[model samples]
Target: MTKLALSDEILMKIDKPARYIGNELNSVVKEKDTVDIRFVMCFPDVYEIGMSHLGIQILYDMLNKREDVWCERVYSPWPDLHAILKEENIPLFSLESQQPVKDADFLGITIQYEMCYTNILQILDLSQIPIEAADRTENDPILIGGGPCTYNPEPIAEFFDLFYMGEGEISYDALLDLYKKMKQEGASRKDFLHEAAKIPGIYVPSLYEVSYKEDGTIAGFEPVYEDVPRTVTKQIVTDMTQAVYPEKPIVPFIKATQDRVVLEIQRGCIRGCRFCQAGMVYRPTREKDVERLKNLRTRC
Candidate 1:
């Protein structure tokens, strides 16, 4: 029998019970026993907002493409559900498998904005996972933070075991494969994180140490180990044409912020506003080929 953390009574009380239940059209369903790695991609907000983000959808499609991996979706429950879960002592669960996040191999949270910091803590608390990375045991999920906010991840660095510095498409496969091999060898959490830092675009917070100046500014950021790289580089796809894009995005049961197919005509705005963070990080503005766009438009 399948186990669900949210009961019928609780679902009935929530405004949109669809947010908790999985199996909407286009969602990936796989036998949990068959996969070596289970990754839960989380967004620190309500379902509608998280569903609108394109980054999670792309990663979901990319990870599920691997036969050995099953990627699931999770969003911060609404206040009503949150209260009930806390009151009833129910652990927060993934929308797909309805399993607690601690069971997953990795718990990846996308930090798009600073305001979502509190919500991230809420996710950890509600899921029965440690809120701080330092407190986590070997059995705990590897807490990872990614997305635009990763550009300046210092503020919430203590909460995440590691941060993916740039685009997920480039380095996630290598990271996941390394994790599977390491887990097979019965590697300790510390050992796994140390090895993971070797991968480009992956920044292991524990591997480095930070010192502050008297004025409350960052005085020094140094790696604890001599072997670890002093700086992590951002991963980028050289050719957008060759990049894998999500063809079938998961459709939600209730209305989402964006209820239609969204085409990424281009990445990195050409305007290059001096103060724009996205423009700077995703610079050199690349656009999809007209032929490819036309084909995609016709197919959808």
Candidate 2:
């Protein structure tokens, strides 16, 4: 499969011209031939902060390894970029394919915490996609979320069609494969989600009806559809050393929070702060495989 030649014109149109150019030494690139799924991996935060996330980079690399899958990036618009989007009426797009978020088969978001709530809305608004799962149609990308915030995936449940709890290494493929198959059969978005809810780690808010007691405590969450779990179990990957990354990283011209090239050192911290969801959800913190860093060291 031939690589899509990222044009200079597209980069020029963007506010941070460097973000679009992918020339980093560690970034991953897969052949375009015989691919099955295309994913637009989005972060609700600005490019600067999101670039500091090593998990996103790892997942992006691993997911792109398959010949059938292509994964790119979309981020919340900066204030200036948001203004440009508002004035130009331009939609949110991916850094790799430069395709609008609407066109992607799966729209995956990394939710590290609660602060990105409004930013999620802003991202969808900028992407020109619906904010609520109920509002979107079958044509829209199946909205998915992951990261620490998924443990209490109640408040934002209305927005995301599916939540990928814990690490998404395998679940990502399962979700996309389900979508690719269901889509081939002309299944509606609702039907796909109802079935997708059956997959472990995928919490589809729309399928499970939530009722609260008079006191506002969650009375019970029940699935309208059959086979949906009463409690959606979080996905966990035992190994981290085998993680994948882009062979040529996307080097942003605009300086990010981590000015130097970045990499993930760990997953799921054990701070044990009762207030923190990730602290509890991602139990049993794990460190990166020391051997993997041999490559990361070369780039740093």
Candidate 3:
């Protein structure tokens, strides 16, 4: 059982209590429900920024809608908070329920961008978990990842068990279902990943061997398993206009980027930049209803 969470007096001394005490009008709570699968929706950055992400909110909302799945958010603690936790010997816990992250069944990290590489290691380390997948034991939660960064997952490839290449709304659903089946069979992490790799839009790096040339360019990468694909395409949600927008975004008591609360005005982009794969792959565009957006602004 968890001890009393950081008390209000302490929260006052620290930053942003709105972020930690989640009475947000739109926040969803399902951890207490009996669910076979638990997902730790992680953002590899400090809490202030991660709590502000619309993508993270969208996916978290979608996943928790499933009766069999419970979703919890995790973000890398700020440097000062990191020092505080280390001194107190406290593991990273979800802001909503104040439970340790290690209790989850699946650790789904969102590699939003490449720059957060070191932060990803920081997150796992803060959670009292191993940074490398190879070192983790069976008791460790399965470390799944995806996001724009997964398009070129090679940079932080060593950490994630599998990368969801495409749009997560569909891809992660398949992954969770597949994992439930594998869990029933009592498959090992290696073998479970072997099968998860077979799913479209899922990239299991362990099944593909990477070799680098002297010049530092990738010399070759060959899939050891016939089921694995050479390149995984990032998934894009086709229709986001009708998507559930979180109006009562979790407001942090402390200041943060867009701390006032904002709505996802749109999704994807129409002007596809050639160099922008997120644009190229995530074709088409969807905009939130203007009336709804105005409502969001009013509420905030």
Candidate 4:
């Protein structure tokens, strides 16, 4: 059995203790020593809200499928526990093993909304990681931001080491493979990030230089190194049927905002609505096959 991060006394005091103690149904648990990479997926919100996000579920399921990777999860602690952690000086921990999130190789935060910007900092602070990406050393976890908000990540760009520009299904494997190879080679964090920038859909903020005009509107934006590509393209899965789908998602102990199983039947839209960010960013609509979805439904 995994040990709880919060003490019995602390758990007793908290409103929803189930949120912190995570041995939920279908949640992935693996031997830490066996994996080369320890990736922690975080949603910068309370457990219930974070648990409802389908993107985190998909990535959690997908990453854990790799024998070399042990992917765990963390969410922003509610105000009650948050205060206690601050007072006690306890590091934020992942749900699976109740291990400190800072110990992980990667800390991937899903940035869905502009409202959760401060919450991102909150996650970092609680994890005992440097709030600024530039302050972090090689010992620190590589901070990554993804989701819709990454399309315009300038506001929170300084906080994140890298941003995944599009659908995770497309480029994550390549990035992970590169990390493993680099780790074995005893490469520096900056060196690894330099190489990572070359990968499709990866945007390393530190690698580029952005200059503002006198009016503070626009100016020059280019890579510092000549080797780096001028443009970081957005990745998309050509075939939705071939993409990964979580057959068995984690069932939270407490009631989540989205309690029932969720199956993503389609991605992107054909309407091309000007107001809809999802329609604009997720171009060229793709859908999963009905039979495949039915099979997934049965598994769920």
Displacement of the residue 258 alpha carbon in candidate 1, Å:
1.9
TM-score for all models, in order of appearance: 0.97, 0.85, 0.85, 0.98
State the displacement of the C-alpha of residue 88, model 4, in Å, after optimal TM-score superposition.
Answer: 0.2
Candidates sorted by lDDT, descending order? 4, 1, 2, 3
What local lDDT score does residue 169 receive in model 2, on the 0 to 100 scale? 78
Q: What RMSD value applies to candidate 1?
A: 1.2
RMSD to the hidden true structure, all candidates: 1.2, 3.6, 3.3, 1.0
TM-score of 1: 0.97
Top model number, lDDT = 4
The TM-score obtained by model 3 is 0.85
After TM-score superposition, the amount by which residue 228's alpha carbon in candidate 3 deviates from its true location, in angstroms, is 2.7
Stretches > 4 Å off in candidate 4: none
Question: Which residue pairs come into collision in candidate 3?
Answer: 16-253, 16-254, 18-253, 19-252, 165-234, 166-234, 166-235, 167-235, 167-236
Q: Give the TM-score of candidate 2.
A: 0.85
